[model samples]
Target: MEKFELDILGCGSATPTTLHNPSSQVLNIREKLFMIDCGEGTQLQFRRNKLRFGRLNHIFISHLHGDHCFGLIGLISTLGLLGRTGALVIHTVAGLENTLRPEIDFFCKDNPFEVKVEVFNPKVSEVIYEDRSVSVKTIPLLHRIPCAGFLFQEKQKEAHLLPDMIRFYNIPVRELAKIKQGADFVTEDGKIVPHGRLTIPAGPPRSYAYCSDTAYSEKIIPVIEGVDLLYHEATFADTDKARAKETGHSTARQAAQIAKMANVKKLMLGHFSARYPDNNILLEEASEVFPNTVLANEGLREKL
Candidate 1:
């Protein structure tokens, strides 16, 4: 309930199409924006969505593919032009820092903020970034080149204090944190009030997984199991399964199969190929396999 939302900036594949942009998305947890895959046109889309630039301190890139990272330099330069001073941390596979550092240096020379690039191995899974609210782990994906998907798991929140119960027990304001952490309230007369009586249990933590351009691989099931929302690339329909295999992308049916096998709560199909004028064929193919499937469109927001 504290804002676990995904904003789709672009959903098209390698070929540029009038229907969709490239690959970019923003996951907002508790008002903190975490950008994933800043494809071309991502900066414009971010502004169109009215997201505050200052809140975005981290950007996670799945791979070094052009469509996935072409917008990084532009966004960094824009952040500088906006007079932002906060350090921007980019989490990606190795070689990205070396590949983009020069461009950033030449363009962002007069910028106020520092751009820090963190590298990780795409062959193995690892916890790339974490905060008090959430933890992000990489799901090693199979692609033409090295690629990794991201799995975001929310950390458990503290129990909510009951206002009426707090007032009745006369618990001091300074003791709220302790009570939320499951400490019992003690009355002045030495009577013990159980923690359950003073607070409401926090809701279950939610999770989201993103796999943009990968082949159908069951190895990711254990990592992404039972997530609230699963966004997998469905670049082609079942009829073009051969094409999908050749390009290291998954068909809609294949994506749904992964979702169903993982027992995910919902499946979002994205990274559409330009060949399909209407993506409903892909949606229908995936929905048949997983009934709770949805299409990922530009500017679309899904909460989990």
Candidate 2:
């Protein structure tokens, strides 16, 4: 089975610190690349991590905040310079295309790549995109602006043929396709062969959920329930609750609460405040509620 992987490009909060950059992450599922957010210096972080840029085709912007999307122009320009000729898809707010078109046009007039923008206004939660291997949906988040989280789910796979059963039943090569596709087969003599007699159920699909720059909102639980991996913002500790509320961000405890409520397999906490030079406080707080919490660091890669 193909696995889902996430690369943390930048984990710091609105401000950049010496040790961390702003919010940016990359999700690689079934060999396709999807970027969550692009903050300043994100391209630098990508290079430092030695990630291959050839497969990065789609980018999801969480909001219009600078910490979340300021690096987009630079990244697109870099992609053009790197000779990426394939069309690039950007999923963002309605006005974002107009906002970036002039700048992108000016920079890419001499380039050859195509940039396609897919707008997702925050009126509701819905499936925004679907490729052959995966589907992407939006989860409404409680941020200062009209923002949404992303859910990436791999498609269910076909059942694998049991080699022993194939040989034992003397299954014909032409019938192998039918068995793998979970279809019952009929013999040349009109004898029925059940699909269960030929194949077992395929494993559960893998999924990853991302919630960034949002305040504590339990409305997202259903959208991210039972996900294999979850990345949520933890912009402050519980002690700074007032500041967190004022900024429309969540504390480490709040992020953990969301993960626990959603029953996610693993939780990754990121978008840390610059004040906390170390992430132990956030991890410690989050792990108390959700034992599987990991502090997201710049260039950290997790294969799920």
Candidate 3:
């Protein structure tokens, strides 16, 4: 495992309640900090959780909703005040820069860092972010407004070369790199050495999917199929499922069904409505449908 974990900043829905803040999470993939949403008080939670401020360079906003993005200015301002020299990039749907650019210019004009806002189309599914280790694709979600979820998939890991096997075969060091990449080693004498005999097979790559503020749509099952972890919004229980359907949100059972349908390893439900004093009922409802379900609360962290 190369340090892949998720931290929940706030899990409450639109309203800021005493029990929870709003929708916000941080994914630490190979130590590259990526903020999923910047709800109000996100920076405070980020600091409360002791995540390094300098390591956070990219923020992905699921939509333009206030709960999903209102904390952008405050976080950017705090980063500037802390003298963060790295350029901060924001990826979200179009029309967010128009709302945040002015505030950023007015509040952080003197800072050394630059805040760059990049827009993406929510209607289209595409890889919005990619690096050497991971690729994040957008999952078109059915929400009240234009919104999209994120699917984070780790790149295939390279197999480890067995020193004993290599030495026994007397394989040249020059061919070790290729062997590690799943290529067979061909000896100078024209003997075929299988890759399995030269290196240990690496485990399959891990994946995580984040789905929030959307209705229960089977359209996403293919996009998030067989993920290691799934964070889906469970804004209501079975009792308030009518409310959920009216508000473009999903019930706890609905979230669990999505996980079970997609064959995900585990399901984490978040974005709870503020009316509930605690999420015990929601958890119970979802667990009945999918036993391997967990409730997301503020400050909770889990390895993927």
lDDT for every model? 0.94, 0.89, 0.92
Alpha carbon lDDT at 91, candidate 2: 94
Question: Which tens-of-lDDT digit does each residue in 1-304 have in candidate 2?
Answer: 5757899999988777898898898988877888999999998888898877898989999899888888899999999888889999999877787778998988777666888999996657899999877999998999899999999988888888778877876889988987888888787688887888888888888899999989999999989999999999999998999999998999999999999999999999998898987889989999999999898998789998
Q: Which residue runs does candidate 1 get wrong by more than 4 Å?
A: none
Tens-digit per-residue lDDT, 22-110, candidate 3: 89999998899999998999999999999999889899999989999999899998988898998999999999988798888887889
* Number of the predicted model whose TM-score against the real structure is largest: 1
* C-alpha RMSD of each candidate structure in angstroms: 1.0, 1.7, 1.4
Residues 1-26, model 1: lDDT tens digits? 69999999999998878899999999
Better of 2 and 3 by lDDT: 3
Please estimate how well model 2 matches the true structure, expressed as its whole-model Cα lDDT. 0.89
Candidate 3 accuracy as TM-score:
0.96
Question: Which pairs clash (backbone N, Cα, C closer than 3 Å) in model 1?
Answer: none
Q: What residue runs in model 3 are displaced by over 4 Å at the alpha carbon?
A: none
Candidate 2 matches the true fold with a TM-score of: 0.94
TM-scores for every predicted model: 0.98, 0.94, 0.96
For model 1, what is the C-alpha lDDT against the true structure? 0.94
